[model samples]
Target: MDRLHSDPGLLVCPDFTNECYCASCVPFISATITKEQAAESLCLVWVATNDDLCIQWCHQLAEETCISAKQAQAAAAAEATHLHQVHQLEEEMAKADKQKKNRFKHTNILMCPCPDTNEEEAFVSDFVLQKIDKGHFIEFYYWTNIGLEEALFSYSTRDDEGLIPSEQDGATVWISAVASKPSKQVVPDRFLSPVDFAQAVPRVVAALKEHDWPNQWVLMLARFWVAIMTHQYWNSNDQIAQQALMIYQEEQQRAWHNAVVLGNGAWDLSIISNTVLGRLFDHVLCES
Candidate 1:
């Protein structure tokens, strides 16, 4: 990235499957990269489109990394975990499943950070957490935005739910999944343009750095794509650019959702504000 950032003349080939005829091509360039590396590369391709090379590269990276069986599985599991608890609660509310409804209330509240910097501020957001009958578990965060409640994050356990011990530091609350969604509304209908987004990246990054947030290259790239895609973008006519744009958006949303889920409520909007998506959210969600 240091090399890519410094050298504007460099070209990124989205067709990683093709032969590299250039003599300057590095060995790692042709070899299969790790998921972490793929995540970072994915961001580069998206930003590189500001030049002319990113469209195909973004599409190819999304295909090779985010759509791979392992990555897709991870994303599916995360989303499924969030949905399961939600559905389970709905069934109970409707009195649809009487026998199962009486089953142990496995739901637990995993506490989360406050909307602002003060810990004393009530952590009004609610999360649905459950260990499935299959012996696995899923965790999801729920928050209100745009006058509606939406799932903020979803996580599926890669390890056994039974083996993992309870969290030691924070208080745990028990809430029925049937709880209302608009408890403490935060998000509002928001939108941004490509140019507006481009201008905000620097400020957001600076704020993140000052706050000592996790702004690692991979995390940053993934989050940036998530932010840009979470809202609308200025339209374009290039077919390749459009295709890659769509896939990156999908990949980033999954990445952000999974990261927050896996992080166990460690993620918050303050940290998100440092990302590319944070900038978009600021324009759309936060009041000036």
Candidate 2:
């Protein structure tokens, strides 16, 4: 045990020390590394945890997001106050759980996604990566509680040159660039099972080669979608999730972060009113 603890490669979370979780999940270190690199991966783990972890993890992620957003002027930069508010909510959640110390072991176990690496980058193409920098493609648009008509409307208007269409008719359309929001709908509720993921791999590959959609954009969306899908399955299947948690906890010091994509609820309809896409939308939907 001492020799394993001495290993430089291992990372045992403070929460998992003293036989709390385990010491074998060293491999999950790499998985956690990848999550840190990509905003989308962070978002997946953020949404998967309970409220207490969500608040704790989100603060760490928000700091990262704030740094990245400032560099790129990404939308998350403006949400500092919002992040603070979330942090404040933590006290409330913490107070609610009176037996916090006793529950820490089990709670920590469920916080992280399954340790296996289902690299989103693998599902994307080099062509897409070469064209889209991580900063630009990290965030995109998604709608909340949208009806079928709104979904169709958003998709149908994508081709119009001037009108920057809102993602939904009456509901909120979220931009994932912010730090405190959840990607509930964007990350599909239902994901492909293990068997289905294997079977669908070929089809996802074919889409990379054949789809006329903006190659890089589609690829970005696909990666996040697939990550969440696989994670969803892992979260539900006790055997895999438990194995992953055990292996990860045994070897390294663990820290949790929420990668839930947040949105700045500020709406600006004028963006569509002024842009060329807006004019194009006028021609197609209004003038036509």
Candidate 3:
């Protein structure tokens, strides 16, 4: 035992020193080592005592260290990818916010149909009239609770020799109202008269109150209705008017189905009664 301790080669092996010290057979070393340290040192001791066990211990330690390194690398990579995605989402949100601010700064024109003259007329706020110039095209956006809707109009001087005969030489603006449905279908041009619009106010207000819609929402809906009314007057020969009439008929049918067959509320019924179909139905009933 003394000869083994005296040997420099044997003393260099930590596993042997740990075993001898723990057994109270050696007093050369006072400091204690951990189990892992002892096990790692066992590889060197095994090389002298048992070669097979030494090879196995060395291989196991190498594999465990390699696995730990790979796991740390994978964790670091995952954290970086997550940070990159968060940055991209923030950038997209900022860009959308900037676009929304720019769009809201412009004023829109509303066009409505006259029930007495059977013609379409454009309505612009005093502020818009002051700012708008001839030959300038204006684009306006309407918020419909569900999504954004856009309309366009261009200002031009009317010539008496042009398609529509005008008594006075004045500036005329042609406006188009485009309704963007949830299904993304573009329904262009609808009409409303001043008398109808006046009558509609109370009914729309009542319906909105009954349905518990916000007061601001009523204003938005009113603006949308006025925008649709600004197109060409109802003429069977006009292709655009005809298309608008077709879409109106389809919408009325769908509303009727929802109300009568699908058990929708009075709000849907009110919508049906307020449109052209309601007037036509009343006329038919009066004739009969």
Candidate 4:
């Protein structure tokens, strides 16, 4: 057991080996192979030779991965169905916005640091701000320092069914900032442009640092801000962009539901925020 624990890689079959095929057929016969290792070997075996032995080994691996073969089948079916639904959504979005090609395409300048800062600080430029706010963009200023419970109380109200409404405005611009600043400190109702918002980033970072917020939290906030900036730019008249925004909002709503309604309330803002940035990054920035 100690040897297996220390060198789990030993149990993993080397690529294109006879042992890889044999181990999948008789998993228990191999004392060195763990369940995970056996399952992986089975996959490789099946990919190489789709024979009766491979079929049996496939079932065996599925059983080992999930609680039961039935559950595994169900999970596989569910994933297939979800993928089909996503395909349908994409098609519908494409057809609906056939006349709106390249509507979401824009230059993103917020991802990098300001060139004038000697590479010391990141700042948003007027060009980016104008681009992101080109249409009917709604600005959102969220306090990053507050707890999840506090955030829920401040931002949303629950219905009788205890569900937060999913109908968030698509054009909303979410900007994370420190909310506990002094009363005398003047904060804007809306950031006029990217240049205006860029100036606020350093102050928020400084406050977060001084208050001893977790380094992870600070980093997450920064990343999320970038994601939000990306989101604002993408949430344009383009059909794909609109569809992506819809999907993003659904994810955010689900996250809020899980956190507040499901009582798993914790600092899980990253889950949804990261999704926004990741899904939109390539679509908005990379495509020609």
**CA lDDT, every model vs. true structure:** 0.38, 0.35, 0.39, 0.44
List CA RMSD, all candidates. Answer: 33.2, 37.6, 18.8, 27.6
lDDT-wise, the better of 1 and 2 is: 1
C-alpha RMSD in Å of predicted model 3 compared with the true structure = 18.8
lDDT of 1 by residue, 1-288 (tens): 211223333544354333442222333344576444554565566556646534444555666675597888998999999899899899877764654476446322212212233322212222222221111211111212211123222112212222323332365544424232232433211222343333333333333334344445334543544454443332545433333443334344455556665765433322333355344334443333
Q: What is the alpha-carbon lDDT of model 1 when measured against the actual structure?
A: 0.38
Highest TM-score model number: 3
Question: How well does candidate 4 score on lDDT at residue 246?
Answer: 41
Candidate 2 wrong stretches, greater than 4 Å: 1-192, 229-236, 239-288
Model 1: lDDT of residue 51: 60
Q: Model 4 off-target regions past 4 Å? A: 1-192, 232-264, 271-288
Give model 4's TM-score versus the native structure: 0.25
Candidate 3 lDDT tens digits, 1-288: 111212233233445545544543233222685554555555455556545445555666677789999999999999999999899999988876876688555323223232222111222222223222221111121111111211112112212213422222376543221211112322221333233343333333333434445544455544545443443333345444434443453455345434544555424322323457445545544554
Ranking by TM-score: 3, 4, 1, 2
Model 3 scores a C-alpha lDDT of 0.39
Q: What is the alpha-carbon lDDT of model 2 when measured against the actual structure?
A: 0.35
Clashes per candidate (backbone, < 3 Å): 2, 27, 3, 0
3 or 4, greater by TM-score = 3
Report the lDDT tens digits of candidate 2 across residue range 231-266: 432466544442332222211111110121133222
